[model samples]
Target: MDNYTPPFNQSLPQTAEGVPNKNSLSSYLPIRTKGNDFDFDAVIGLVLRGLLRKKVEGYSYEQFVADCQSAFEEKLGEEEFWQVLKEMYFENKDIFTVSPELLLFRAQKGEFAAGDSRVASMFTNLLQNMRVEEFEAKLNFVEREMLSTLREKMKPDSSLQASEKPYLPYLSKAFREDLKFLASRPKYLLSEIESFLSFYGFTYTVQLSLALVDWRSGQEPVAKPLYFIMDHERASNERTHIKNHGYKLFNESATRLFPMLTMLEILQPSSSEKGAIKVPLWEISKGIQESKLTHLKERLEKFARAFKSQRNLDTVLDESDAALDWLGNVMKLALAQFSIGERFNINKRYVLEVEKYLASHFIQNRGRSGRVLVLNQDYIILLTNLVVGEKDKLRFYELITAFEQRGIFVDKQTEQELIKFYERIGNVERMSDSGDAVYVRKTI
Candidate 1:
């Protein structure tokens, strides 16, 4: 035969002296060391123990299970450990009876069975042990629900019915109980009070009542026609010394107070009628005074050069047109103040400032297109540009003071009247000072 050589000649021999080489023997015999040294069954037992502890301590089932999984992964290699875990605690019933040591030994020996039914049975036992903890968590959830329901009951109703009685008695006992609870939590109770006051009807009533009280206490007896209109309804049975005065002064006071009342009405919804029936009179009077001042300032500017030219002797000069114009402007300004005060439900001071700032720009620019500036009741055609340059401040104040001082000759009494007006409504202090107050400057 032609020198026949075997194809297997290069292959390593199976063994030395008829036995395979060490590396070659591994392929056939498959030298199996411990597949995983960890005892998964024992780990399951440890997790069960932890679950029992957590359940006793009132932890939820879900929380207990999560903790168990976390502990196992932290202590063992995540991959090998969980796989073995699923086989033992989940996939085999033997895990429950077998000690962790025996389960681990069997697992290393590769002898555990796997199936969903076996896992299900194991989980059933695990959940049964966690029942107490689940009940505790459910109890906590129920407590939260009860507390929330109680809070809803304690909250005051802001809606006004035809009959103006207090609605607190209509609330359920549970609501009363909630109020008690809220009272114990002072912070939350205050929050509820704030929310109650925020309701339009409630705010209007409270503000009106407070304002009436303040106005009654603040002023002395006067004989103006305006005051009479304000006190006309109660002028007959004058128990208080102030009401003995003529109603005209009361009407003026009422006229002054009308702006505030109008503001309250405007700020509140039409449906709201919760508190007082009438607006206070002093607020209207204050509003009127402020408007007259602003008008006086404007009219004075026109007559400044004329009066200055006449050496302050322009009093006898006939300026019927200017006087009529000034009167009309004052009326318009008063209406504007009332409108803004009502719309924003703000103080007269704030309303006057906002109007002044707006009017300055409108007059300077000679009006803008499609840009209606409604200041309280006064309407102009220029939007207030908040952006101010360095020199803008001095210029604005100079104009306002000059306008005020100029009226000294043309209408000396009105000029004096305007000075008192500025003291009450204008923010002259903020104007003279250069600070962040500029951002909040209400008028020119």
Candidate 2:
């Protein structure tokens, strides 16, 4: 009996077909029966201890059973251990649960504890029996509590009635951080503006309208709650300036202020169909305005200036310029096509016209003495003007053709050669066929 040590650590033998055999109670019974006189209570205690420890240690089902066997043999003799194990196994099979902490603990320690399959099956069945609305209500309750806490943290200085609590509670952690940052800031920061814009769909009508007024005046607004200038001097000034300057001051001003306005609008509470506060927009705005947001406005403005300058250039002379110009053009063309109620179809030769116009301008603007054409800051400014006009492909071609038709003599051979060069180098495909012909293959 003393010599009958079980093959505890040995790898199980494989079947004749090479599949490994599973361990069974009968396989260990011989070693259990052969052990010397065993103490049943001590064996039970050891088994329980091993099981509990294994539960903490996160042992797998097979490893757990093996642990139980080892504990039993160390205390009770092999014979009585099986009887005690059998009794306990049948009595308390249903009372077990695993917590997230316990799961994490086991994972950290590399313990492979086997969960009760029967318990999981039953729990899943219970969940399956619940209605979707019941589940949603439970989730909503949790969300409501979370939102209430957030609303309290975001509360404005003014007193709020009990009935005026915010309805939505499911804000992302980033949004909460943005709110706090905005609340700390003395003035609007880019992060706060960006976050607010993201919250809403980036539409800020009130701010846009107000900015239009300021742009016309070429000055900042005097106070908040800016009134719309219907027939004001500023409006007249803006109209005259835009007409003479070939650019809209109002548009430029709107672009500059758009982000902040967008943020404010998004942070505002949604209004009910009956014009009641579904959530107070002012409260949200107040919190954001108070927060100290990270300032990226300077960097953004620099980038915008560089971008605008690049847009004005005829041909990108450097790799960096080329990449920037390509991106800007793509965006511009996409926006222009979208605005014209076109789904990027080849219904009109708009893009081609623009390219031709640019090519003609590039030729006409070159140095007359056969010198290397230097694309300076002035050239970039000129190009910017061309881009803003949103000229179509046919118009651009005509512009170029007109320049060539004049005595400007833009090396016709070079111009033609360059046209072919652009067509080949720029992957410019001509869609001669009608009705989405350019994208028919793409759709397929």
Q: For model 1, where is the 10-residue window of minimal lDDT?
A: 377-386
Shift in Å, residue 11, candidate 1 = 99
Residue-wise C-alpha lDDT for candidate 1, range 233-286, written one tens digit per residue? 122233222233222222233233333333222212223434432222343233
On lDDT, the leading prediction is 1
lDDT of 1: 0.27
Report how far off residue 246 is in candidate 1 (Å): 15
- Span of 10 residues, lowest total lDDT, candidate 2: 24-33
Q: What is the lDDT of residue 16 in candidate 1?
A: 24
| TM-score on alpha carbons, each prediction | 0.16, 0.16
